[model samples]
Target: MDPIRTDVDAPFGRIADLIALNARQSPDRLALADAQDSIGYAALDALMDRVAAGLQRDGVVHGDAIAICAASSVAYAAVFLGALRAGVAVAPLAPGSTPASLARMMRDADARLLFTDAAAAEVIGAPGEDAITRIALDASAAGQALADWLPPPGTRPFPVDVQPASAFNIIYSSGTTGEPKGIVQGHGMRWAHVQRGARYGYGPDTVTLLSTPLYSNTTLVVFFPTLAFGGCVVLMPKFDAAGYLQIAQARGVTHTMLVPVQYQRLMAHPAFDAHDLSRFQYKFSTSAPFNAALKADVLQRWPGGLIEFYGMTEGGGTVILEAHLHPTKLHTVGQPAPGSDIRLIDEEGREVPPGEAGEVVGHSSGMMTGYHRQPAKTREAEWFAPDGKRFIRTGDIGRFDDEGFLTLFDRKKDMIISGGFNIYPSDLETVLRAHPGVADVAVVGAPSVQWGETPEGYVVRRDGHAVDAAELLAWANAQLGKTQRLARLHFIDELPRSAIGKVLKRELRELNPS
Candidate 1:
């Protein structure tokens, strides 16, 4: 049975059809916006047709995969939608990655064409991977410009059947080093996401500002929904606190998806309050741990509903924290979303009792099919029940409270085992963050001489607030349990993060491993 129609008896309507409907209804309505350009619904819809026609004219067939490695732009978005119209899978890769890694990913996804821009082409080092052809979104002299590559404006793609299990897009995992895993999400899973647009008040009037990289699911989750529902999406190629505030006010943005770190930065910005963001109807955050204190500050100051989404790109049981309604439950990631079956399991894969922290595994209608072309790794990511139902392993250690709200305890791999006791690094980091001088902090487990593994703290101090590493470590340990005490603490200028603002804990562990 299909999950996208939302109602069990309702016929599934394609998101592309909805876009076409939107175009027919409101041709002049703004559909997409970027720093350099903005396109109305009718023009954007027509552009997609041109893109699809060009792909077909170039011998690209249905079920084949193409890639887009450029930063977010109107052209990038057009090509993506165009590929879907042609029943072709898309692999949206990150331009921030090394050339070798990006090339390797294109090969892995079996991408025959790479839609890129001048900046991204430079990063990919000439796009010299296999027989892949390159088309420049920014019209660089090095490759075929998007304008020239696209078919005539009136051209339309031939119709193709897009079934529930048809491939949608391949989102590469955020592995800073080495070959990243490509998560294959299908059209059905994406349609479910689009169906959820109504919950966030998405419509023709909804304007969303997406500052995160397009490659990250954190950005696409909001991007697809806004466009599908005839809303305008404002893209930010690079995230800047001042620029974001400016865009929000200028665009009259009603919705946005930001990681916790982006929120922290926005909240810390001196001019954040000065911005006129009264149009915001909803603000969504995911992809990293959100501090309760920060959520409180946003609720107190920002005008809109703040929702925290807890789930992975692989799609499993989802938890949604509606901070506006449940003020007291801000510390937790809220209860499982409707129809989301979230459960906890012990080390041996046995289901854990309520209130006990364990690895999170979930089953949902929106879960991914599996990792692309990696059957062994895909099986490793799945957990089967005694009844033979499949669930995705979240790799996050968490617990369900009496009310079913989940409180995460860092990643399962990040959890430290010291003297046969579990030590969650987030627990240690939370305590350390309470210090007045700490601007930011991350705790990672290090190899230990006696305890096998021990917690080590890396900190970024508030400017002009003096606190020695020894003093901060001693203070933190005094507040922590005996087994949870830190083994060492070091001060740093900043905590390293990925493009989407996830803390690089592995880098910290490697840097200070005991």
Candidate 2:
């Protein structure tokens, strides 16, 4: 039995502590790698030590928050883990966010120490204007370089006694401005995430490839587990289909966590079938709605287990679909994960019976503590059951089949009200995608004088297919009920997407405001 496995099976364990133990047990093992360089367990452990000591020397105390708004890098990982070792909460700001949003997040987290890389620095600007002490992850960025900012060699900070409920990190939600929804995830929540990895095949010999940036909670779910179980990590600063495939093949990568759009691109790549991904053990998808056709194509072509995780960054009510194991249930997002209490609630806040459509609410040991400094907003997101137990509202409308699988509808806010009827945009988008010529699509409610709000679609044409928007709209409406017909269809080169690959429906709405 592996020493790390024994530690991983404990009731609750800190990721930082587990990494420390792995360093002692397997000092020579490769712990992290990027396009430019790699580091062994021993060196990584010492590097973390230097980071923690340097932070302490700079007066960043335990329980205080610090932010990192940068691309993925070996140094970025060390700073994150090292801060955890010191009991400080990390706020990973999305680099793809507008410069104003990033700066606002720093203020929202009350973070004084900020970190950035060369790529992010281009947008985030120079750092000396405020009280923030910026540390540049790479050379030529605004802040102090990590090497020059570190404490002396062989340095170690005073050890911290970490508790499970201590703040682990603050993950902000998607927004351009105003008060950010900083979700404060405790160490307890993260421990449950690591514990759940046993079933997914994460272990010391596992080499997990991460193409997503370090800031996303979507990426961290898999990134943290690999380290806690003594596995190696390979980071990609930017994600491109051909480059991602080359690195996955060269590194003998066993695992990866990609959002749905990345999978779509990979499956469409001509060289996808040519790549030798025989060593792959697990491939994960999350953070966006996955298309059934895309999932089917991957299952038919891709090697290894394909798992789709449906959950929020706020950490409640997780649903897992192991596509390889249950090939028939490709449309449903699987049953509730073990130990997760998933329930459905009506608009009146009453719990609904199974087999009926309702909003998704979930309770689990892995739920977040609360939104940072936003008690009202946090309370708004919770619903107390008759037993007084708390459940996080998923804001998604879904129905459970008699067998317990969940078929998701559009978000409650996104559900269109047309002629006093509820029209799910996902239903309309599904029809448009079936036309074969439509490569990507997004449906939003357009202001309608007659129906109040009607479904409007924005489409991207598949290469070499020239289907007229008006004709496709008519065809889709023919397949739909009278109330669910599309108001208009606009063709574009591509669907606007977030850095994590979620369709930017708001952008689409703004572009075609009625």
Q: Which is the leading candidate under lDDT?
A: 2
lDDT per residue for candidate 1 within 123-190, as digits (tens), equals: 88854335588888888864788888888779988888988788889999999433689999988888
**Candidate 2 ranges beyond 4 A from true positions:** 176-179
lDDT of 2 by residue, 333-425 (tens): 988999899999999999887678999999998999999988999999999999999999999999999888998997888899999999999
Q: Whole-model lDDT, candidate 2?
A: 0.89
Model 1 alpha-carbon miss at residue 153, Å? 1.5
Q: Which candidate number maximizes TM-score?
A: 2
RMSD of each: 2.4, 1.3
Every model's TM-score: 0.97, 0.98
Clashes of each: 0, 0
How far off is residue 219 in model 1, in Å?
0.7
Worst 10 residues of 2 by lDDT: 171-180
